[model samples]
Each structure stands twice: as C-alpha cells, then as structure tokens.
Target: LPHRYPFLLIDRIIELDIPNLKVKALKNVTVNEEFFNGHFPEYPVMPGVLIIEAMAQAGAYLMIKKLKAEGADGDFTVLFAGIDSAKFRKPVRPGDQIIFEIEGLNIKKSMGKIKGVAKVDGQVVCEAVLMAALKKS
Candidate 1:
C-alpha cells in the first residue's frame, strides 16, 4: 500500500473481487496507536479522518489489483483526489477491529471513484465516496 507502520491503516485484505470491483479489508485499532495519545488522553477515540483513510486504502488496493489483473504493469500510486458525502456514524476506539468495504463506482483511465463504508462489530462507523487518481511512481 506504499504506507509504513503508524501510517498504514489497513491490517489485512479479507476479500478481493476484481471482476466485481469490490474489496474488503480490516484494521485493528490498538491502544498503542500514536494518534490515541493526543486525540484524547482521558477518553481516546479514533479520528474520523483516519477511518476514511482506511477506506481509501482499501479502494486503492482494489484498483491496483484490478489494474494488475488487466495486465497493466507499472509502479503506480493512488492518491486521493476528493471525498464526498462523508459521514461519521460511530466512534472507534482501541481494541476495535474495523472492516472496510469498498465498491468501485467508476473507473476511467487513471481516475476512479469508489463508495467506501467502514464498519465495526457489524455497525457502520463511517461512509464516504472517494475519488482518486493513479499515477506511475
């Protein structure tokens, strides 16, 4: 995912369906997270932006995998171009495992749009429509 520890949000890819343009990924939040220390010392909560970022990563994975399956070869990087209709439904905390479901809405050339939903314990924590661009790196 081109991301390293502390910044990489996704822990695993549970599902990948290139034909369907969908992907599911997981992120395990822990008390040791660097953001928890400052987000709230008294009562820590996962930042909403990070949840969205997790979803974006999952979408990026889907796009990259799809591109590879199509035999397009390159060192590519996906960058967020925009986010729309983002909503935070619940607060995430340490020990919570987040599941990100991403479905491609549109993909043309180097640009793509996806609908992302973040869930914890089967309950939605956040949802957003993400736009991204793929560029050779």
Candidate 2:
C-alpha cells in the first residue's frame, strides 16, 4: 500500500468491511527481515515500533481504499497523525504471523482515528489507537 518492501509490513489482506470500517490483514515474520539483523543479533525479536508502524500502515491503507471506493476526486495521501495507548503485550519472533485487526473509531473529511490490535496465534501481541489525516499526494 504505497510502501516498498522491508518498510511495507502487510503481506495480505484476509478480510475487509469498508462500511463497518474494519479490516484484518496479515504480516508473516521471518528471519530474512532486515531489522532482525541488528534489533537483536543473538536473540532476535521484532521491534515494537515496527509492529506499531504496521498497524498504522494498515489503517492508512483502509483510509485510502475507502476513499477510492467512494470515488474521491483528487489524489490524496493518508498520513499518520497520532498514536495513543500503544502497548506491547508479547514478543514477536520469526515464524510468527501478525494479524492486524483495525476498526475505525472516527473519520472526517481530513482526519481519522482507528483502533488496531496485532495478534499472533489468536493472542494479542500489541494494540494501539492510531490517527491519520488526508493530504494532497
């Protein structure tokens, strides 16, 4: 979603409900990830920040897609506006697949807020409230 490899975290979108403003996306973790090299050489764990970024990206994607589906007239870019109540509940390692479940909390002409949960094996690993704004691309 407008993101290049290594920086783009979403691998696939499993479910989407644009009207409800909810989506479920996946990211497969692997040793090949560049962050694994220095995040922890001996005992690698996916960085918490990256997980949060993944959540934000998923939220942004949702905004972009919904706007497109609504036939927005201009080229718009979704930008991360804020993050709140971010929590890391567990460590993410290689072989783990993060299921990002995001629900829109509020959306407006320019700004939007969404709540996201990152899960691994049905257990939540991280959660946050993310905000974004629409801007000229």
Candidate 3:
C-alpha cells in the first residue's frame, strides 16, 4: 500500500485468492495508535471510518495483487469512489485484531466494486460495499 505508519491500517495479508478475487487481511489495534488518543483518550474505541478504510485497503491489495499476477504494469493507486451500506455493529478497541474479508463484486478497467466485512473474534464488527477507481500514479 502507499500508506505509511499510523495511516496504513492493514498489518498483514493473511489470504489471497487471485482467481477468486478475494482477500483477507488483518489490523491489530493498539492503544499506541494516534487516533486512539484523539478518538477517545479514556475509552479509546476505534473510529468507524477507519474500519471502513481498513476494508478499502484490503480490497485495494487484492486488486493490486491481481494486476501484478496478470503482468499489468503501472504505478497504480486505488481511491475510494464511494461506500454503500456501511454498518457498524460493534465497537473496536485496543488489543482487538480486526480481520477484513473482501470479495470483488465487479471489476472492469479502472472501476471496481467490492463487498467487505470486518470481523473481530469471528464476529462481524462492520461491513460495507466499496467502490473504487484504479489510477496510474
């Protein structure tokens, strides 16, 4: 990803199925996070928007990896075009590890749509449908 520390929410790509257009990634939430300090110094719950961002990052990873496998060339970056049906079911806090599962719903040319779900301890915390555009950087 083009993100750096404190912004790059994805910690690892645990699974990738290129042919299936699916990916699974992890993000370990910690009290040391900068957002935690401002989001809530006392309670420290992870922001809902960041969870959605994490899902988007996972989807971006899947698209990038697929492009690589297909021998596509270009310094590309994925940018959010839209987010739909986003729902936050539970709060995420320090010491929680979020697992993002993203599946491509439609991908053609520069536009793509993906369904993403964020889970902690096998329970869904958030889910959304993300739309993005792949642009050459």
Candidate 4:
C-alpha cells in the first residue's frame, strides 16, 4: 500500500477474510510494464522478486486493514522486515494476471509474518514467507 506507480504491484483485492487472516489480490502484467523494457529487450519475463513483492503487498494490505479494524490508525506504515523460503516455480510474461494468496502466520504489536504465493492460471509462480513491521509516523 505504501508503494507508488512502477512499484505498487498489487492491482486489486479479490478476496479478504480478516478473521482468518487471508487475502487474495491480483496484478495484470502487460507489455507496457516498465520492467519489461530492461528486464529483457528480446524476451521478457517478470522478475521473480517483483512477484514476491506483489505477494508481500497483498499480505501487508491485510495486516493494515485488520489493524485498522481493531482501532489502529491508518497512519501506520508496513515495512518489509524479512523474506524467506522464496521460490520461483514458473515464468510470468506479459498479459498474465498474477494472483496473490496471502495467509497471516503471526501478528504481534508491531510485527507480523505472512505466507504468500503468487499464481497464474492456477499454477504457482512464486512463493515466500515475509515478515513486516508496522511503523507509525
């Protein structure tokens, strides 16, 4: 949610279950994507790290929303604290819609962990476990 254009990865939220700490989001990759230009001029494949970022964004969105519902202010920011078990299972190209499945692993006063998976056509493309910390401005 703190990301801006060319950085903001998640396009939309398709499903959100706060009580269960789950969130599903989407991102449509297009030929016009800025990364496509330099990532590869002849053949382009979405960078695996961006897919992980998308998943983390989705996860952070869930945490922020849940925090707000619990009476926390919207002024807090989510910062990536750690990433682990990241695996790239498939290549993502233009015109592909990435689906992010984020499940909350744990949440404390200012820290959280989320297990995230990025999928396309129902196949996993990338996945990772992310840790984040909430900072108030």
lDDT of 1 by residue, 1-137 (tens): 89888789999999999899999999999999999999999999999999998899999989888888888888789999999999999999999999999999997559989999999999999999999999978
| TM-score ranking from best candidate downward | 1, 3, 4, 2
| Every model's TM-score | 0.98, 0.95, 0.96, 0.96
The C-alpha lDDT values of all candidates are 0.93, 0.90, 0.92, 0.90
Clashes of 4: 0
Off by over 4 Å in 1: none
User: What lDDT score goes with residue 33 in model 4?
Assistant: 95
Question: lDDT (0-100) at residue 22 of candidate 1?
Answer: 94
If both were scored by TM-score, which would come out higher, candidate 1 or candidate 2?
Answer: 1
lDDT of 4 by residue, 1-137 (tens): 77899799988999999999999999999999999999998989999988888888898899888888788864778899999999999999999999999999997659999999888999999989999998875
What's the lDDT of the predicted structure labeled candidate 3?
0.92
Q: What's the residue-level lDDT of 61 in candidate 4?
A: 90
What's the residue-level lDDT of 51 in candidate 2?
A: 97
Give every collision pair in model 4: none
Q: lDDT by residue for model 3 over 50-131, one digit each (tens)?
A: 9999999999988887887888888789999999999999999999999999999987659889999999999999999999
Model 1 TM-score on a 0 to 1 scale? 0.98
Candidate 1, residue 112: lDDT: 86
Considering only N, C-alpha and C atoms within 3 Å, which residue pairs clash in candidate 2?
A: none
